[model samples]
Target chain A: MATITTTRDGVPRAASQPTRGRPDRGFGTIGGYIGRTVLALFFAFPIIFMFASSLKPDNQIFADLSSLRAFLPVGDISMDNYKAVFDTVPAWRFLANSIGVSLLTVVLGVLVNSLAAFALSRMRWRGRGFVLAAIIATLVVPFETFALPLLWWVNKLPWLVMQNGQPMWTLGWLDSYQVQIIPFIANAFSIYLYYSYFSTIPKELDEAARIDGASWFRIYRSIIMPLAGPATATVAILTFLPAWNQFLWPLMAVQSENLRPVMVGVQYFFQLDVAWGPMMAYASLITIPVLALFLSFQRAFIGSIASSGVKG
Target chain B: MSRFMIERRGTAVLAGVATAALALSACGVASTSSGGSAGELTLWTHNAGNPAELGVINQIVADYNASQSKYTVKLQAFPQESYNDAVVAAATAKKLPCVLDADAPTVPNWAYAGYLTPLDLPQDLVSKQLKSTLGNYQGKLYSIGMYDAALGLFARKSALEAAGVRIATVDNPWTAQEFADALAKIKADGKYQYAFDLGTGDSGTEWWTYGYSPFLQSFGGDLIDRNGYKTAGGVLNGDAALKWASWFQGLVKNGYTPAKSSTDAFADFVNGKSAMVWSGIWHSGNLSKLGADGIVMPPPDFGNGPKIGGGSWQWAVSSTCGEKAAAMDYITFSLNKKYLAEMAEKQNVIPATEEAAAMVDGWQPGGAKRFFLDESAKYAMIRPPTPGYPFLTTTFAKAAQDIIAGGDPKTILDQAVSDIDADLKANNHYGF
Candidate 1:
C-alpha cells in the first residue's frame, strides 16, 4: 500500500512493500480469489471443451452437444482416438523428435548465447555499446524478412562447400534436424535477456575473478555463469516452449513428413472432412505437454517476472 | 541518471541472453542421406499423411518413370492450405515440381501468369466427358478434371425411424414445405432432432442465390443485368434472396433445425442425436466409419431443381518445368477409376467417374446407397467459373452470414449485390 503512493522517485522503497506476517484485509482477498478463479476458468474452458470432446465418440462430439449420459461413454471412451494417434501418424516418434530438437536447442543455444552475452555484458573494452545496439536494432526486423538471406547463408557455410559447380550444396540441410534446430537457436529475445542480465551483475565480480589468477574466459565460466541461474532458466523456458509449439518455422524449413515435427501432425488432424473425436484427441495431446510445462515451471517463471518487473 | 543506469543494465542482459541462445542453436543434427538409386524425379504434394492413398499414387509415379527410361520422380508434401501458396512461391523461385494437385480457380490465374501449361484434350473429348468441368475463358483446355465434389444429405436410419418418417426415392424427395413438416415431426417425436448442420456457408449462399434465386428468376427477381453491370437498382433488393433467408431463419425459429452450434449432422446423426444432416459427397468416409447399420437415405428431393453444390478437382501442370508429359501421365493414372476406388471408398469421397463410383466396396454403411447415387443430385450446384468467384463467395457468404446471424435479409442482400457488383467490375468477371 505504501509502495503505491510514496515510492514515486525511489527513496529506498523496499520498506514500502506490504509486510508478510499477515495480510491486512481478508474480505477483498476472498473476493480476489473468487475473481481469479472465475477468470482462470474462462481461459480453461476451450481446453476443457477439447478434453471433454476427446472423451466422446466421434459422432456425438459435434452433433450431440446435449448428451448428458457421459463425460466419457464407457465403450466410446476406448483408446480408438489414441490408437489413431499412434497408428495413423507416428505420434510418439514425432514427439520424440520434438523432444530431441527442443533439448538440443536449449543446451547448445543457451550455452553459446550466454557466452556471447557474457562477452557483451561484463568484459566490455570498446565498441560494446555499438555492438549491443546493433543486435537490439535487429529486433525490429521480422524473421521472414531474413528468410531468403539466411537460407543462402546456410548454404554458403564453409564445411558444406559446393562441389564440382553442380546445383546442390553439400550441406543438404533441408528437412534435416540441423535445419529445424539450428536456425531458431539464435533468437533476438534470448540475446536481449542475456544482455540485460549481464548488465545487472556487478562489474566487480568480473574484475575480482579476473584479477585473482583467472583469465577472462575462466572468470566468465565460473562467476558469471552461476549467478545467471535464474536468467538462464528464464531464457530456457521462454525459448523452448515456443520452439516446441512452433509450426511455421519448421514448416518453412523442413520439407518432408519424416522430418516434420509433432505440431504439423496435430494440425493435419483438422484437415479431414470430419474433425470431431480425433481432432480433439490430438489437440489434447499436444496441449497437455505445454500445460504440464507451465504448471511445473510456474514458480520459476513467475519469480523471474516479479524480480525483473522491479529491477528491470 | 538512474534511468540511464537501468537502460544500460537492460541492454547488457538482453545481449548476453541472445548470444547464449545463438550458441545453443549451433548443435548437431543427425543428417539424412538419400542413397541414390538413379532416375528419381522430385514431386511436391499435400497428401503425405495418407499412406494407402500415397502408395497408389507412388505406383502411378513409378509407372510413369518406367514408361520413360530417362526419368524418376521424388515426392514432397506441405499442409493442404499451404499447398498452393508453397507452389506459387516455388514457381516464382523456380522450385516447383513437374506437376501438382491444384485448386481449379487458380489454374487460370497460374496459367495466365506463366505458371501452368495447357492440356491438349480435344473438343470431342471435352464434349463427351469434361464440358462441365473445364473453365472456358479463352476456349482452350488448360487442365483436366480429377474429381467432382457434389453436395448431398445424410440421415440416420434409426433416428428417422423413431421420428416415423419415410423417403422413398429421388423422384419423391420432400419439397420445401414437406421438408419443413417432416423436420417438425422429427423434432416433435422427441427421440431425434429435426435436422442439424444448417451450414452458413456455400450451401446457404447457394440456397439464396441459385436455389431461391431460380425462384426469383421464375417470379422475375433480377439481381442485375446480363453483364452484371448495374445492381443498386436491381430486383435482388426485392424478395428472391429474402425468401431464401427467411426459409433458413424459419428452419431455426420453428425448431425444425438445430442452432448454429448444434449442427454437426455427421457426428450427431451417426451418434443418434438428430434425424438428418446435410453435407457433400466428401463426407462418405465418416458415415462409413460409424458402421452401415445406423446410417440412412439422402433427403428426399427438397424443393429445388436439378442443382446441388458440386465442384471438381482439376489437374493441371506447371509451366515452370518441361515435365508436362510425365505430369500428364501421373495425372491420368491418379484419376483412373481403379486408383480412385479406395480413395472414394475409404475417405468417403464420391468418385469422379462411374467406374470409380462402382468400385466402392469396403465397409459400406447401412442405408447409405442414397448418398452415393440419389438425393444429392437433385440440388447440386457449382460456383460459377468467373475469375471474380472468390470475391463473389466473400460477398454472398457475408450476406448469408448476416442473415443467419439475424440480420435483415433484404438489407444484407441489397448491400451484397452492390458489393458483388463492385467486385465483378474490379475483376472484370461481369457475367450475370
Candidate 2:
C-alpha cells in the first residue's frame, strides 16, 4: 500500500463546490475537471462494456462490434440464459465454495504475513534480514513451477503411506479444500505489503506497550494488529479477489461435482454443444459479484493506499 | 464500546467456522456402489442431447429393464467435453458408472491400459465389419466407433458463387489439383483468403495427416504395411505418403488455404468463408448456423484414385462395469436395428449396417450426405485399427507443413518415416 498525492490528472476529484468563482488555492479549475473526466472514463469503460455485454442477446454477441445497434436482438427481456446457467451448472454451490476458500485464504494470509512482518519490524531476532531475504527470494520462482510436485507430495505424503502396515503420516489432502488453500495460504506479496506498512507504524507505540509490561505476542494481538487495519484491508482485497477467480489449480485438484467450486463448475458451460446465450449468461453471473464489490469499495481502497505511507 | 472483545470474538468465530468448513469440503470419499445389492445399475452417458436419439437410447434401456428382473439401468448425462477428463479421474477411484463415451481416438488408450472390458459379440459382426475399423492395442479389441465416417467436401454455396465458381454436380467434383485451384480462385477473387488454414505445429500436421490420409489409400499407398495377415500399413515411407505430401505441400505453398485454423478446421467451412473444407460428414450442423445453403460431395479424385479414407466409432464395456451381462444387454439394445435408425436420423451418422441404412429413409442432410453414400462402393477407406494411427497423423502432419515450408516433397516423406519410427520406439519403452 503506497500512498501519494496523485497529480491532479491522475484521479478525478469533483469540484468541492460547483464553481462560483475561482478559489485562491487553484480549486475546481478547468484543467482539474478535464483531468478528472479523462481519468474516470479510463476505469469506467471496461466495467461499462462488461455490463452491456452481459445484457446482450447471444446471437448478436458474435456480431461485429461496429454493428452494436443492430446486434442487440429485439426480444423479450429474457432471463432464459440465466435460467439455463442455473440448470446446467451449480452456480450457488460454486459461489459458496469460492467465498469460503477466498475468505479462509484471506484470514490465514493476514495472520501469517502480519505476524512475520511484525516480528521482522519490531523484534530483535538474529539473522532477521537473512530470514526475510530467504522468504522474499521465493517470489522469484513462479508458483506454477512448484505446483505439480507440491500436489503430488501433499496427496501421497510418504508419511501417510502406512509404512509399517500401520499408517504413520497420513495427511490425505488430495482434491480437498486444504489443497486449494494451502498452496496459496501464505503469500509473499501479502507479507511484503504488511512489512512495508508495519515499518512506518510509529515505533513509539510498541515501546509504550512494552513499558506497560506487555509480552511480544500480546503486543501483536493488542497494539500492532489493531493499528494495521489499513494494510490488512489492502491485503484482504488483493489476496481474496484473485483466490475467488482461481480456476486452474482448483480444477486440477477437485474432481467430484459436489466438491467443485464456482470457477471450476462454471467451466461446464463451454460444452461441445454450448448454447451461446447461456454461456454469456453464465459468464456474467460469476463476474457480477466481484465487479460490484470493486465498484463499491474502490474509494475506501484508494484511501488505504494513501494512509499506508507506501509512497512516503 | 468493548472494541477489543468484539474484534477477538469475531475473529475466533470466523477461524473456527473456516477450519470446520474446510475440513468438510476437502475430504472426498467416493460413494460406495448402490448396485449388486439388488437390480440397480448406474450408467453414465456423454450425450449432447439430440432428444430423438436420447429417446431411442432411453427406450432401449427401459425395454431391457422391463424385459429382465435383474437390473434397472440408471442413466446420467454429462456434457461431452468434461466427460473424458472426469471419467478418467473417476476410473482411478473406481467411481465410473457402467457406460462411457469418447472420441473415436481415445478408446484405444483406455483399452490398452486394461481399464476396459471386452464384450462378447457374434464373431460374424466383429469379423466382417468391426475387426478392422475399431482401434486395437497390442492384440486386443478395446473399442469401436459406433458408426462409420467418411471425409467429404463441404462448400458454402453462396461464398463459392461470390468467387464466380458454381459447383452444379457431384460428378464434376474437383481433384487434388482442382481443389487447390478453387482455393486459389477464392483468394484471388477476394471472396475469401483460403479461409480454411489447418492448425500448425503438432495439430496442423495432424490435419493433413488425418484429413488427407485418404489420399495415400486412394493412390494405393498405406500408412501401415498391415503385413497382409491381420497387420497394418507401410514398412517405411510408402507411395501414399508421397501422394498426400505432394498435395498437402501444394496447398501449403500455394497459400490458397489459411495456414493456421485447427488441426481439424471444421469450423472454417461452417463460417461461410471457406470455399471448401475437406472434412467428415457431420459438419452439417456447423454449416447450418451460417445459413443452410451449402453443398457436400466426395473429395475430388486425382484421376480415378483408390478409396483412401474412412473413419469409425466403437464402444466397449469398462472393467468397472458391474454385470457384464447387463452392460452387454444395454449395448445390444442401443445398437439394435431401431437404435441404428435413430443414429442416422438424429446424428445423421453413416450406418454401420445395410439394414440400418435402409431404415434411415433419406437420412443424409445435403448433397454431401448423398455423395458419401454414392461413393460408399468406390472410395471409403477405414483407418487401420492398429498402434499406427497416431503415428500416421504425426508423420503426415509434418510432411504437410514441410511442403508449405518449401521442402522437397520426396525428402519430406522420407524424413517423416524416421520421425514416426522414433515415436513408435518411444511408445514401446513403457517406462515407469
Candidate 3:
C-alpha cells in the first residue's frame, strides 16, 4: 500500500498521484484567478458606485462620473445624503414593512409550495402529470399579462375584519400588508423547483418511514425536508427578492404611504427637481438587506441553481 | 398506517389548506361605494415628497376644515410620480376620493369620462384667476389651480452681450432669423461647449410636449385644429410645422445645441458649460443665486409669435362625490386670494390671480418675476382642449424625439398626425 503524505499546511496528500505538468497547471491557475478578478470587478461596479455616490455631494457625484474618482470615496465625503434620506422618507417604516412582507413570503412560500410539490412529486395521484404540466405551463404567462385583471379581482376579494368589536366584510384589499403577502405565497417556480428536487430523493427512505407507522406529514417533516436545504434556500432567496423589490403591485394596491415598501419610496425622490443625493442614499440603504441575504446563502443558492438547471 | 390511509390524509390536508385559503380570500368582500360617510370628505393630492407644496395644501385643508363644522376633510397624499396611476386604479375600482387634484392637461379627458364634475364656484372669484389656470371643458370649468406655470429662455446676460445678441422681450421677441443668427454668433464665439441647452434629455413626455410644442405654435402650427378639436391634418404636419421641425433639428445638426442634453442641463448652463437654457420658470431661484447676470427672456418668435404652454395642477370634484357641494366649497375656500398668495410665495410659483400676484413680492407689477406673468398672459396657449389631448401630446412627443434622432421630419410628423387623428376618430373626437 502506498503511504499518504502530509503537506506543510497539514492537509493529507496522496502518494500515488498521476504525473502532471507543473508549468501548465501554474499558468492555468493564474489565468483562472485573473478571469475571476475581472468578472468580480465588473459586477461590483454598480454597487460600488451607488455607495460611493451616496457619500458625495450631488455636483461632485456628477463631476466625478467620467473619472476613476467615482469609484473612490476620496473627496468631500459626508453623511448628509444619508441624513437627508432619513428626513425625506419614512425609511425605518418602509424597511420594516419590506422585511415583514419578505420574511412572511419566504416562510409561507416554502411551506405551501413545498407541500404542493411533495404531493405532486412523491404521491401517486391519478392526474398528477397533468397538474404538474399545468403548473409548469404558468411560467410562460408573465405577471404583467394578468396584472390588471389580478388588480380587479383582488379589489373584489373579500377580507374579514373586526371594526369596533364587530366582524365586518371589507370589499377591497387595496391598502394592507396582507394584500402584499398572501397573493405571492404560492409561487409556481418555487413549487417546480421543490418538485424537481424532491423527485431526486431516494424513495426507500419514505417507504421505510411509512412502514415504521409514520404519516406522510411526519415523513415530510422528518425525512425529505431535512435534505431539501439547497432547494429551500434557492426558493427563499427567489421569493424574498421579488417580494422585497415589488414596486408596481404595491403602487397600485396600496394607497396609504405608511403601508408602502421601500421600492415605492424610491419614486418619492423623483419630484419636479429630482433629489439625486437622497435617492442614491435611499438606494444604498435598501440594498443592504438584499445583499446580506444573497451573501449568506451564496453557496446553496449557486448549488441549487446549478443542480436544478435554473438560472437566476 | 396503511399507504391508502396515508394518501387519504395527505389529500385531506391539501383540501383543507385550499379551503382555508378560499375562505380567507372570500372574507374581504364588502361593497365600498364612492365618497365617505355624510360628514367626512376624502381629499387626495399629488404632493407627497414635495413638503413645501404639501404644507401649503395641508394648511388650506386645515383652515377650511376649521372654518366649518359641516364637513371634515381627510387628506391622502400620493407622490407625484405615481399619482396618476393610483388615481386611475382608484377610478377603475369606483373608489375615487370625493376631492382630488388632476394635472391640467388631463382635466378635459377626465371631465369627458365623467370622472370630474363642473365647478360651481362664484363667478366673481373665478373671473379673478388667470385664464390659463382654469381647466375649462366645453366652456364649463372642471378644475382650477392656485397658480400657473410658465416657460422662458434662461440666459446669462454677459453671454448675450459678448455675442452682440439683442435681449428678447415680451413686447419684441427675437425673430426666427435673429434667433438663429444669435446662436451662430454664440457658436462662433466658441467660449462655451454649446450655445443653448434645450432640455432634450428630460424624458417625461409632458415635458417634451409642454417645452417644445410651443415652438411649433410659434411657427403657426398646433398639435391639433382647435376650432373643432377634430384632427391634426394641416396644423401639425403642414409647411409651418415642417419649418419648425427643420429649425429644431438644425440646432443639433449645426452643433448649436446638444442633440441630447443631460438631465442636468440647467446645472450645466449655471456651471458655464452653456450660454442659454430653455426651461421652466422654476429654475429662476436657482439661477438668481448665480447673481444678477441671469436673465429670463421670452422664447424666440419663429413666425406667428412667441408661445408657451399653459396650465398647472388644479383641484376638481369627482362626479361620484357624495358631497359635491362640500368638495366645491373646499376648492373655493382653498382658492382664496390670501391662500393663493401664500401658496405662490411658499412654492415660488406664479399666483393664479392678479390680486394674489399683487400680494406676492416678486410677482408684483414691477417685481422681478412680473416678466413671466406678462409672458404667460400675453403668449400662453392652453394645450388642445379636446379629450384627445393626452394622445396628441404623447404621439407628438415621440415623433419629435424621432425627428431629433435624425428621422425624416416630414415622415415622422406625418406619422404623428396620422396617429393623433386615428386616436381622435377612435374616440369620435371625444364628443367634439
Best by DockQ: 3
- Candidate of highest TM-score: 3
* lDDT accuracy of residue B378 in candidate 3: 93
Q: Write the per-residue lDDT of candidate 3 for residues A1-312, one digit (tens) a residue.
A: 345453332222356755457666687889999999999999999999999989988777767777889998868999999998887789999999999999999999999999999999888879999999999999999988887788888888777887766556887788899989998999889999999888767676788888888878898998888778888999999999999999988888888888999999898888766778789999999999999999999888887876678775
DockQ values of all predictions:
0.22, 0.14, 0.45
lDDT of 2 by residue, A1-312 (tens): 223232221221223424357465565577788899999887875555444545555444434234444334443437777777777777788788888888899899989889889888889979999988988899799866776566556655322233445434434365477777877878877887788777766676678888887878999999777766667777888887879888656655554455566776555654433355666666677777777766765765665677554421
In terms of lDDT, the poorest run of 10 residues in model 2 chain B is B28-37
lDDT of 3 by residue, B178-270 (tens): 999989999999999999989898988999999999999999999999889888999999999999899889989999889899877787788
lDDT of 2: 0.61
- B120: Cα error in model 2, Å: 4.1
lDDT tens digits by residue: candidate 1, A18-43: 64486657888999899999999889
By TM-score, the candidates rank as: 3, 1, 2
Interface RMSD of candidate number 3: 2.8
Instruction: Give the best candidate by lDDT.
Output: 3
Supply candidate 2's per-residue lDDT for B404: 68
